[model samples]
Target chain A: MTREPDSHYSSGNEAVIGWDIGGANLKAVRLSREGLQVVQQPFAVWQRRDELAEALARIAAELGPAPCAAVTITAELSDAFRTKRDGITFILDALQSALPETELKIFGLDGKFHHPAKAYQQPMLVAAANWLATALLVARDLADCLLVDIGSTTTDITPIGGGKVLAEGRNDPERLVRGELLYTGASRTPICALVQRVPLWGGWCPVAAELFATTQDAHLLLGHLPAEQCASPSADGRPATPEYALERLARVVCADTELLSQAEVQAIAQYIANEQIHQIAGAMTQVLSRVKVVGPVAAVGAGAFLAEAAAARLGLDYLRPATLARGAASVAAPAVAVALLLNEEACV
Target chain B: MTREPDSHYSSGNEAVIGWDIGGANLKAVRLSREGLQVVQQPFAVWQRRDELAEALARIAAELGPAPCAAVTITAELSDAFRTKRDGITFILDALQSALPETELKIFGLDGKFHHPAKAYQQPMLVAAANWLATALLVARDLADCLLVDIGSTTTDITPIGGGKVLAEGRNDPERLVRGELLYTGASRTPICALVQRVPLWGGWCPVAAELFATTQDAHLLLGHLPAEQCASPSADGRPATPEYALERLARVVCADTELLSQAEVQAIAQYIANEQIHQIAGAMTQVLSRVKVVGPVAAVGAGAFLAEAAAARLGLDYLRPATLARGAASVAAPAVAVALLLNEEACV
Candidate 1:
């Protein structure tokens, strides 16, 4: 989800912890009714389930005793053989065990927040939580619109019609190969799959099979993707560097590049940048075709490079959660949007 | 390269051999000038390039010696790599040795044929051979056209502008990753990468990570992809089905279904078909954005299933090469178009 500005809440100063479980990172935002505060910590979902729970507990502890907590889990946490329901159950159980006293609202697809008792009635609660949050934030204006939320591992293109998230297809990897899931993402996407040729100064080049570069490296070089986002390690928890990106991307194919110069690697980076632009543009076009979205296109996630490029290509106004959620540095725009929606609903 | 009718060459007796050397298959076609008598063959391009050569030789013996050979070497034989060039050279040398006194010309991108004296310029030669055949058939009419050749492993979207092939990127796998080469193809492409979800009767499903289905299976079931074009085991050294096309396609994905019910397999096939359509649509849109072509799209290669689907979706005219080649059953329309173009240039 895209980063958003922190807004002050003045109602009850009781702290509420918001958790954004992503494929690669577990981002948490602790807020009280008074204002937003920073909880400086890093959480990796790639850790063991129990270890991850402990990390979440530590974050919760930092927030002190919170009266309520809203948690959303997202990631490639399960193997191919496992079902989403099973995966969701495992994560929810872990969250409950770690933070017992606080009232827990697990998100699901029914467009309602429910406790463990009602979990069986609805599926995709974790996925729906984020969508619900997104929906709640923009409900007034987005009666009939397409919500394109690009994250590190996958892009969620949900068509929102009549203030609800229009269900398209499953938003996971297996479904990814089926058309509903687009595999390209911001952080950890394989670069080899993006482009087929690299353009050199003189002419185009066929990239050698070696881990040459990635979309991150290309965006970093192109200045389209920010270094801050690139600062984070890959989904696999590998550090990001030009050398590492190149090394991983080169592995997409087999090439003898041990003796090759750095210039060749740079050329591959340029090619990847161009291809990323192309793919982002294509995906944006697909989203546009499915829904009749006009004017402003809400861009979210760490993939600002793609968002900016898509904005230019589609000739639409772009809204980034990062810009809107400026002061509230702790809460991402998607999380904030969700919180705001839930708050509004709580009052009603 | 969509198929065009055989109006250029009327000579009924003379036959020409067309060979497509790929990473997985050696596809060859022998056709009469009038396109009447035709013989098509395929050989598995597994390990052991020497065995591949022997397999081709056997096919040649079955088809008998032709007046001339028009060869288009893709993948490892496209002279893109040192090993590929050496392999092609070995195969051509063997062909010459097996059938003496016949003129053997290796195709290149220079739009010209070369003898052994100029064999060092193999890369340019292969491109020229492909272009020579392609250029001659269409000539002035080829401008502003995108030649989409979808084989087993990858697809080539070459733009023809100003009566010349637009040389933008390398026609190999490494360069292909750079976006200059689109990896999605008709046969043998991994299904896991197609789509992430499949819509079932109840809800959208995330495909399991096990050997399930492939694009080949989808196309075959849809009846848009012809079974005759599929590779199979044959006594006469021609392309024959390995067994059931469905079984081969099932091997492309990792879905546990050794004893899967027919309904289950069909569901997987449906998902694959959906993914193929999405990919083809996306790729076609990319080509349309890059170039402006006025004429009908010429769809060629084994993956015509995608091309046809793309054409239908885009509301564009679809030209099938086989329909144009008429009597030339062996040489697909796109290949025939290339061959006719080469023949015309030879006469000129």
Candidate 2:
């Protein structure tokens, strides 16, 4: 892997922070002119929305004092349409309330920061920034690359060309319904809504209304989702455990087995694993159809199953960031790519 | 085929009307002493809730002057918890308002009609009536059977025992989440939420967010959902067509293959078909697991593909009712079975 150029510590003390607010977990990293440094303590915003402000305050306290902070928020608080704007507003408001002294910049699709100097309303820019960061950090040769960031509630498949992220779709509901927003995500996705049928030993089986298992359980069983990730919060703030995952999965389809026999549950888990892999692969193919990329695809997400499955299915080389970066780098490729682009543009 | 007893239709005025309010279609059968005359009109209520009430009013006007009517509301319109009682009340009020002079009795799961004379609610009475009608007029010798009804938004799988419908699972959302409600249906089901991956030529593929197609299109292409069924009124009162079905199906997965080659579109259609068949088969297996039945499975719905796929996968005999009476007959079988038991108990 090519190492990033030595950090050029700018005179400005302003720092940029990227936050990935998912349905199950909240991840944030702090980056300065020096580079990314873990804030030491990360905030956990699970089911309790009321605690969000407090959590951000705690995170802010750990970050000490900074001149300015950039925040990007994405979560599965509700259906796509219901939560998108509100979720962003909530996070921004909370951050502003918590760190009142810092120069707060809320990032949208626009690459420009939402601050006093630059009034940027472009959502694609922020999306591109995230995408760019991911590409630069992971795929150094960002040109002709497709960056897929699969999260809990949705997936973002972006094409990179000429060292710039291409934004073909909107991240909103109407666009989401129109194929702009990839709906299939890793956590909290209803299984019944996934595969219509699960092939059994003798015949096919249909899922019941009950939540039998979630993709989390399937990934856990396959050892794709690690214990650390599993222990994170669910869509609601509740701690996500193997038991919770199993209980949710068990409810996917109603069966007599209250606590499914290990074999039976495993069968469902395997089915989900196969389906998830299939979905990720299908998305990769779609991205490939649009852009002619020279190198292997790059994936950045907490969902290891998604990345691994896509890599294996496409028979392409894949890379995961060695260590999580602060700010946007938590998402890897996009964060790094965005940072690189910003740095180059600044130099020019 | 067993003939109905002469006494079954001896009374010229003894007739009962069965109304099934499904998410996609509204089916009404007037079983008078003169025989069953079925009037089936399809309507889409996904976006238009008022149209549902108007459609029911029109049906009531057409069935005017009937002594009594048994209406079953099965759709997303009525939440079991909040609107179960209110839903029944609304339907009865509508029916009463339409048929001012006729005596209309609303049917509830409790088995007893809500009338001034009844002190206790006999929930199983409706099941008994449905069972009696089926056994008396349709399946005479079939003792144990599974009734699968695939509607627009949901599927109902009822098990029959000793001529009575087994009442074990709750038909509402609570029980639905527990196993009673299977949310997968034939049409209008969002596709993006279905499978994680699609099968490409050699490997699996992930689905994009574009509205591609739905199970409705799959069934239509596969010749399972009939042209007549496909012609149901959309929410806008426009007649549905093959192109519309394709559009709807594509919308499920957020795929718009109108620009795609026929071969490519066909492949996507096939993938949807595979998922739908799998879903139906899975649900069928769930019902089969709970009850030990010897006879073939009986399916009645607009989704012929689901029934055929389920039957073929399970190696069970599949029976389709010739007319709309199939639903009434299916429900009647268990009703009759229980009635027989009640009769035997009374005699003892």
- Most lDDT-accurate candidate: 1
- Worst ten-residue run, lDDT, model 1 chain B? B234-243
lDDT of 1 at B279: 63
TM-score list, all predictions: 0.50, 0.53
lDDT of 2 by residue, B1-348 (tens): 112322332224455555655445566655555554445565644335566667777876675445555554543232221222333344445455555655544344554444411212332222112322333323444456666666565666666667666535543333343233466667655454455555443444445332234455656655666666554333212335655554444334333333233455566667877876776677667666767766666675555447667788878787764322343333222222222222222111
Question: Model 1 over residues B152-209: C-alpha lDDT tens digits?
Answer: 6565555567666653444344334334356666755545445545555445544422
Please give, for residues A100-198, the per-residue lDDT of candidate 1 as tens digits. Answer: 887876555555556765664443545435645654555466565545566554555555667655544444433333333455666555453355445
Q: Tell me the DockQ of each model, to 2 decimals.
A: 0.04, 0.07
DockQ of 1: 0.04
DockQ (C-alpha) of model 2? 0.07
Q: Which regions of candidate 1 deviate over 4 angstroms?
A: A1-13, A37-47, A125-129, A141-146, A158-181, A196-214, A235-238, A250-263, A321-324, A327-331, A345-348, B1-348
Cα deviation of B36, candidate 1, in Å: 49
Each model's lDDT: 0.51, 0.49
Off by over 4 Å in 2: A1-14, A22-24, A32-52, A75-77, A80-91, A108-110, A116-129, A136-144, A170-181, A209-211, A232-253, A256-260, A321-348, B1-154, B157-348
